[model samples]
Target: MILYDEIKTLSDKYEERLKSQIEKRVSEMDGDDLSHHILYQVLGVTSEEGHDIDVYQNKGRFLYKYAGSFLEEAAKLCIKSKFPDSATTRVDNTLGVRPKKFEIDMLVPDGNAIEIKWRDATTDGDHITKEHTRLRVIHAAGYKPVRVMFYYPNRTQAQKIQKVLQDLYNALDGYYYYGDSAWDFIREYTSVDLYKILEKIAEVKTGGK
Candidate 1:
């Protein structure tokens, strides 16, 4: 329950951050308050024939796509700040591929695989299954101290996944986090505020945009 409370606070803070970003963008649109307009545009973009159109108008989709990677970077940074060792937090590292292949989000110094997902619909059961396989294979290879942790935001679509993943993680001796619970996991590992890290990343990214 404490984890749920932490997650709620973190989710509220994250929503505020998003609202702030939208307000800033609207202000930049010649003070037109086009946040709603932008939202409409974001929801309007669509993929055709399994290919998405790459255009400036699709900035919303682009942001949504990059959010997961950005969160991974934030988590990696938090871990490195606490560890201060390059080898402690490796991002997007390919471990091994013999009987099965494994590419992970973050490889902790303790040999834990941390897979971060951000409410993307594409990251469904199949994705979880693959990651589970990778973890099992890695564990079988005498990888001591091996663990897999999944972090994802809580959304309407994620309710079922949260249940499914809880069972999967339990069976694997791993952990699954959703909503504010994920913030608890990050805090447990690094004692850093993920929301703050994400805010800084957003600032830097907006400058480039």
Candidate 2:
């Protein structure tokens, strides 16, 4: 069995490395921070009043789907670094027909089954409701549901997005987001380079104590 301290130590070290990488990528953006900015806009709050709902919906769909790809990349990093041997990462899967069609943002194999989610930045009450719906589907399908919320740097005008996420999670039924205080875990788990985390986990396992 993996000791708690060992897991914590490895998680911390990996998170530090992840923070540097994410910062670099954010800093390198030339135009607007397209991913986050687009996400907010697509959700329909960033523009002037009476923005066309149809246009917003189209843009939102495009942005959300694009972001799903990014989430998969991040998930792959997480699985590779922390649970390399025990995990297999996938973008989305369809198990059956009609109501059973679920698009997972990322799927990581935990001990007994797969953990899935729809990645989002803020889990504000409204957003959390939607997340909960997805979680319900996953639970019904005999898989573990994990909600992964991305923590971004606080904007000067917006008093940190993390608080909004917390409020959203608090309002949810029975489930909560796990990475706010444990952001160190996010840093350790995500990677810009796919498979890097898995390779690291393998190295650690190979050199085990």
Candidate 3:
């Protein structure tokens, strides 16, 4: 079974860290920081009015960074609980000069090269090239690249990027699982239902609602 207590502890720690960061950022929102939002200024948004937007934008960044990290680690716990021999490894990027190595989130004894992600909303075209190189290297190393992304992006551009990635993976003999399918894949492959564990923890957080 997966460690629910450890997952809960991780969630709590992330929450506290996020809270502390937000408090620190908001406290330090001085005149210089508040006055530099060019688009907000062009929209006739006063510094006082822009404060809310700045706060939320900063909060969004923190949330995005932490959310991805928390879910990836949680998924690792679930997978490693089932396959204790699995581990992360860095492979040489034979095709790239910039990124000399690509980090595989998990490498199982059976040759599954796992790439865990909570969400991917990248609209950058260069990201596709980097991922292609990464996958080619993985295939060259005899590991089947498998992407497990728990959440699907909401925006249209992001969805298009993901579609392209999915096609790239299939073309290269890699696997891509996202949204509900990703969760199901982990459950079936690892024999651990990650969604149920997170849902129960969330219920406790939301007062059992």
**lDDT by residue (tens digit), candidate 3, 1-209:** 23889889989999899899888887776544444766677999876678888788898998989878999998998889889999999998888787889999999999999999999989999999898889889999999999999999999999999999999889889899999999999899988888999898899899677
Could you tell me every candidate's TM-score relative to the true structure? 0.53, 0.35, 0.90
Better of 1 and 3 by TM-score: 3
lDDT of 2 by residue, 1-209 (tens): 23323443555565565555545544453333344455557777564322344345444555555445444444544555565564543323343333345555445454223332334344355544454555555565556654444434345423334454345444433233443422334454543232344346556757643
Clash totals in order: 1, 7, 0
Q: Candidate 3 — what's its lDDT?
A: 0.89
Best by lDDT: 3
Which candidate tops TM-score?
Answer: 3
Pairing residues by index, what is the TM-score of model 2? Answer: 0.35
Model 1: worst 10 consecutive residues (lDDT sum): 48-57
Better model by lDDT: candidate 1 vs candidate 3: 3
lDDT of 1 by residue, 45-143 (tens): 433311223223344644564455445555666666666543333222245443334555565656565666655444376766665566565455434
Which 10 consecutive positions of candidate 2 have the poorest summed lDDT? 111-120
Clashing pairs in 3: none
